[model samples]
Target: MASVQHPFPPLLSQDSADIERWLLALNDVYASDEVALIRKACEFAAPLYHDEVDVTGASLLQHALGSASILIGLHMDHETIAATALHAVPNHLQDWREVLTTRFGANVTRLVAGISDMERLRHFSELREAAIADKQEAAQQVEGLRKMLLAMVEDIRVVLIKLAERTQTLRNLSSASPDTQQHIAQETRSIFGPLANRLGVWQLKWELEDLSLRYLEPLLYKKVAKLLDERRVDREKYIADIVAQLQSALAAQGIKGEVNGRPKHIHSIINKMKRKQMEFSELYDIRAVRVQVKDVENCYAALSVVHELWPAIHSEFDDYIANPKPNGYQSLHTAVLGPRDLAVEVQIRTPQMHHDSELGVAAHWRYKENKQSESGFDEKIAWLRQILAWKAELADSGEMKEQFKNELLQDRVYVFTPQGKVIDLPKGATPVDFAYVVHTDLGHRTRGAKLDGSIAPLNTKLQTGQRVEILTAKQGGPSRDWLSPKLGFLQSARSRAKVRHWFSEQNVDDSIAQGRALLDRELVRVGVTDINQEKLAQKLKFNKLDDLLASLGRGEITPRRVSLAIGQEAPVNAPRASTQTIATSDGNVVIEGVGNLVSRTAKCCSPTKGDEIIGYVTRDRGITIHRRDCPFMQRVPEEREDRLLEARWVAKTN
Candidate 1:
């Protein structure tokens, strides 16, 4: 594929001042070696992307620097920042992967590869001919895209890198054509913003939503920004005064907490206005203060101090700490009558709750999406964030590489279907597993598969971004070999179960034949000759000969049971009596009939060795033992009632 060249001016083009500023911002967060790695990446990528520009006519080198700066702001690792710098290299330079791997080690190479995988998503997202007009369809499409984006990458850092890249594009939207800006803004608003929100990346989410709003709804964004700016000084002073009073009161009361003015962004204010159908004057939270304390008790205590200091609006009080939002977000919200009869909002929360609200799943819009539970993907993101947090705490540790390897996504590989739909599976998943993930019916009919348009083995393990096409029979089921571990055809347990279930529900006649063949083979292996099939079936509590054989084929019954049943290998503590009171293995049941009428417990009910069992005389079959409450026994025809007989356990001779 030809390299896609950006046609815009670079934000950092020929600007050593901008590049040095970027490096300076990293000084606080990154160590010497980490900073060196980032600088090396920039130095390496500058020549490659120097001639290229982004859609906004910004230099690709400048765009890369801008994105890396964003990751640095997010406190991302050096590898993430480095990868952001070279994200476009693989597309622009031939043999970029090999060079990157050789120079930066496997971790940076992996990060670059992840970025490359996400570039396809960017193209996929941006190729829409026009903005979707239908509100519902647009929402659903964006929602699906969000899921696909999250499902596409192995490293959550890749997602952060993507977000940073999008943020840079939005920031530099001025130079882009109106059409390109609109497309990019729409994608950012509908796709990237929600994703950042879901991942609890507040800084990225806010900038994305704000920038997208600025482009897409220029007039409204200006209106909100103008209104906020008009009273910005007054509001800041008022909030500062209130925070001062609260701080003094808390200090006097021996409380430890932080009280800060909450500056609501333009996009958020506009969204709140639209969502609540409220006038700007009615929004009390426009000038708000958030109190973050050390613990739950401190949160409540701080709330009391605020309420005591000011009279709260009766209907504006919410005790979220007592009743957290569905997504596990907790905070105390109260709107109060402040100095000069002005309305102000106060939010009191523990530091942890505040962290979760900002950077955890219980992000800014906690009530908007009340998901029942966080998905595995969401959990992985949370884990990645935890790792980032630990990196901050363990900044001096030398074991970061080993720790990263241990914590990185190790089991799951996210791949794309030929049409760009993401299918997540275990690391070693094959096309068959991919088919199963798509649909069980597709898996059942999967006859062959192609990996990246070339025929590959059914068991060929998939890698990230590999397009898989499953060739299926018009009418067929999954082969039994797919369920066999020795065949190496399937790695997914769900796929194996589906294949097993299909075989289990197969036509009884075929199952019986297969079962019979399996039993004969096992019997031959066990050196049991001329075994009474009917007696064996009864002893196993199978009502019919076919049922017993089918059970064997389905692997519900092990072959060792056959050897034990035929007395070729006596079970532990077997009763030795063999006359009128002949004892079955385990002394669970005594034969009620004469001359070796095979009596065995039924599999359907799984009657234990000592459980009471009744014998049912099956035609051309020996007495089949069943628990009294067995479903088959209760449903037996009235004519077969005579076949039912009393059976009891035999007392073993010590």
Candidate 2:
């Protein structure tokens, strides 16, 4: 296949070369049909984005190609590659979805949509200084932010595409301003680099780290780069010579193995120096070669060959394969005296181990991104990797889409406070829930909210990466209406519980005042007036008036019973009798001074048989019974205590 030249602008013209090079690269890695789909997508996108430019002032078409190139290097599937090509086109063309579906089919369209959604992470880009200034907290927050990104996308491939795009952006970052470079570099280091690392995309992960280091510490980067370049050719020659000798020895020993020099990147070298507080001369791995064999046995055999070829440094040998790291990294490492007494490190492992070390279980990114594994985010990434491994066999488009929907990125939404601190919440959580999640005091005082600088309803469901600002009163508690499910003001159960607890702790005076207001409202609704308070309170078993009012305020007693007990006409079809007294239910009660005046029990306090009971003569509906110590009875006025009637349960009544 002929190499396809970079397709320059004046796009959609006849002279543009076909992207056969990219297609050929995908041929062996993907099914013929999947490869064809990717070609169709690339051809469709090339013309549409040809005239565009990206944030770094590069051709948007070239940027897309660069991003697709990164995914291809990861050996990603057709959907990911195709989506990378088309992720930017929708921004330029109207009805892009219809166009995508008509040309590349629905699967590609869906992939494009997922990629688009994942790309919208600008709020994370603007985190407050407080969030990142503290090392430990920043690491935790960054880990959470990575999980948030992973959890936000419907398909794991969307994140893969995003990482690819970020890699390309950083690759061409020199075209951007110093400010843009620093900003982009910081974002990659804090978020995308670690994300790539966790996903085991070692190729992108290392480059991201190296590039970020380049921009973040320019002087150190230049110094190290200059030093490495000074003897680059000599180092390469020496490494090549060592690899040749190792490869020849392994073959002669009937051991099939691959040997290569592991160039110590500037960033990694500097990190080790600073971390270990060592001088450049003290670094044994400055010159290193890795040997990858077929199995564990072959790994030891290869290590023997390396030892026989050079004198091993006793202090530098580590048999990690026998005792793996906590994250499951496996290898045999040793430093040896090489040609001219130069120190060179050798790492021996199986090919599988090597791959794992690069982008598998042993990759450094996995441990960094998931040091705190309480969230099981590491397991999610592992599952995603498993899914990607079978991408070629995932022939059922509908099933794949459903799997994408059912799993990955659905549990938590990462939103931002106005101060830029990230606040994580369950999906479909409301702004009031967000307020409560931030602080209990904030939740209690939360009266209004501002979402993205616009005043929003308290119940508005928060989306990932939306900036939220809660408007609170100087002092107040949550409304009782917030506890009402039908009102839909709050969604978080924690917030609801907090509100309930606040109300439960309210002062008795306040409860009584509120309870009185509710009782007055109920009286007006029932048209009851001039009631004998003492008799009512005594009949209800309350020794104090305020106690009865407090119970009413707390909803321990319903207002309907107050009307019925006082002999006011009940609401139409309302229950005419209260169940508070056993005598009313059994028709066995005797009220002194009231003879068969339509007796009933008060529902507020259900007085049982053998209990001390009292009664109040209603205006018309006979005497109502109550427990002697009921809170309602205490509300009765002393002057009106005459209306209190003695009632008892008759043992013989059936």
Best by TM-score: 1
Q: Each model's TM-score?
A: 0.67, 0.64
Error of 1 at 349 (Å): 5.3
Model 2 lDDT tens row, 1-654: 011122222122222453555467666666778777777877887788767788788777767777777666555556667878789877878898999888888877888887766565545446553346778777566655565566566555677787778877887789899999998998888777756655555566678888888899999888877877887899889999999998999999999988999867676788888978988777888889999888999988888888899999989898989965422457999999999888999999887776665554223222122244333546645454322212222434667756644654455678877766767787778888998898999999999998989999887888877889999999988876665455567767777778767766888788788779977885565444556665666666788667778876654554545544654222333322323333444456655444446667789998877777778767775677888788988787433455675555656455
- All models, RMSD in angstroms: 12.3, 13.0
What's model 1's TM-score?
Answer: 0.67
Model 2, global lDDT: 0.70
Summarize candidate 1's per-residue lDDT along 380-484 as a digit string, tens digits. Answer: 455543322121224335576455446434456656566555565777899999999899999999999998789999989887557789999999887756755
**Residue 36 lDDT in candidate 1:** 86
Alpha carbon RMSD to native, model 1: 12.3
